[model samples]
Target: MSSNAAKLIPVFAALALGTSAQTAVAADWYTGAEREIPRDDWIVAIDAAATVTSNSSAFGAVTATIAPVNTLLDSGPRVRLQGVAGTYTYPGTVTGQTVRGVQQEGSVLFGYEWIWQQAAVAGYVGFNVRNNELSILDPGNPVVGTGIGGKVAADIYLNPTPDQFYAVNASYSTQFNAYYVRARAGFAVFNGVFIGPEATLLGDDFFNSWRVGGHLTGFALGPMKFSVGAGYAYDRVRKGGYYTSIESRMAF
Candidate 1:
């Protein structure tokens, strides 16, 4: 081949390579992490807990919640069923069948969650079923009252290992507002169980209560997560009482 022809061929090949490189770079560009929103199709979480709380007045109730799926959200229209029933020995050693429960329906909440990429900070506007039910300890003669509740929280990265999540939340009901803050970190405690303790601050019309406790959760079952928690709620009026909760959750 002629020298001129050979030189022209090399130039065309270089141009083709440059064009291919540009296309590849554009296709491969990515932000690294994807913000995944929960699916809207469906969700249901059931929690069963017992609270032994009572003042000079009466005993507390067993707390249970059957929260049906609304839209996919930290915010959305929802119907939550709350029930609490239990017995306690009064100062007089009195005990019997004590039960009280309530149901609540609320409008959709706004600002489900806030995610910051620059600082790796995450925040969420949390909405729970308003406390439409308040029961006075009287299994023989239970009284129900309607109330409301609220919550908001944020979490920030503290450790470089990305294994710890520190979170804070505020929750209140018409009865009274409860404030809670906690620093949570998890390690392989046993059998890969992630356990973290959180301090709870509770305030209300009946009395003031506080608790410090945690939950043990792990992916033990196939394609499912199992969690159970226990805590001690110290009431100024009700004295000292114990609380326990168990939950089974599945995600698709």
Candidate 2:
């Protein structure tokens, strides 16, 4: 349990630490002929589907957050920090370009969250930025340094009830690279164990895709909050391919 909370620390830190108006951010390569592929040609992963409200005008992002209203009324503000990394690969074709590329991303999330004052659920807001690394897969080709991008998200949800969120508020990233908007729901099978599925709509460049995944989170572990999620995305362009990721968030 302690290890799980450690995984989510970075995500909580990027909270208010994110941007405004809008910020968007994305991933690896599947196919391409040019060792020098344009940013647009990059395959956007199918993870996020909706736009958010916590972003700034810098990167077409929205970080929307609704005040929390606790059903128990005892619910109060929650704070946290999180950090994470991921790797992805795909196929592409670049004219006059080369097919030598690799990508890596990581970020820190920090912010405050709690049950909405008007709703029974919960939500949070924060800032986040990711360092993207691009490289030449060819041993003989020169490896390009990693590129940089930014991201931010502020959102509110109906916490996790038997049914998905009765209501939700969120933001999305569009400019940086790619992001998504989604609706989430789940159920608790046992003590300190919750599992549910989420549906996501990917951002631009990346083919639009749908995702179904589950998360496991616990809030009773003292001041330490921990959660992890796994999901698969179905692509419109790749009938047999899917996008998958595991994420965790924690509060200290």
lDDT of 1 by residue, 46-127 (tens): 3333333333222222211122434221233333333433332322113533333343433222232222221123233435
Off by over 4 Å in 1: 1-108, 116-144, 147-162, 173-183, 190-192
| Candidate 2 accuracy as TM-score | 0.45
Listed in order, each prediction's TM-score against the native is 0.47, 0.45
User: What are the RMSD figures for all models against the true structure?
Assistant: 16.7, 18.5
Tens digit of lDDT per residue, candidate 2, span 1-252?
Answer: 233222222222222110011112333356533343112111111111121111110111222222133211223443323333433333333332334233333433333444232333334444444443433343332223444444455554442332222223344433344565665554555643445666666543433456566555433333233444455655543344333333322211
Q: What residue runs in model 2 are displaced by over 4 Å at the alpha carbon?
A: 1-84, 94-101, 104-152, 159-171, 206-208, 215-231, 236-238, 242-245
Note the Cα lDDT for every prediction shown.
Answer: 0.37, 0.35
Name the best candidate (by lDDT).
1
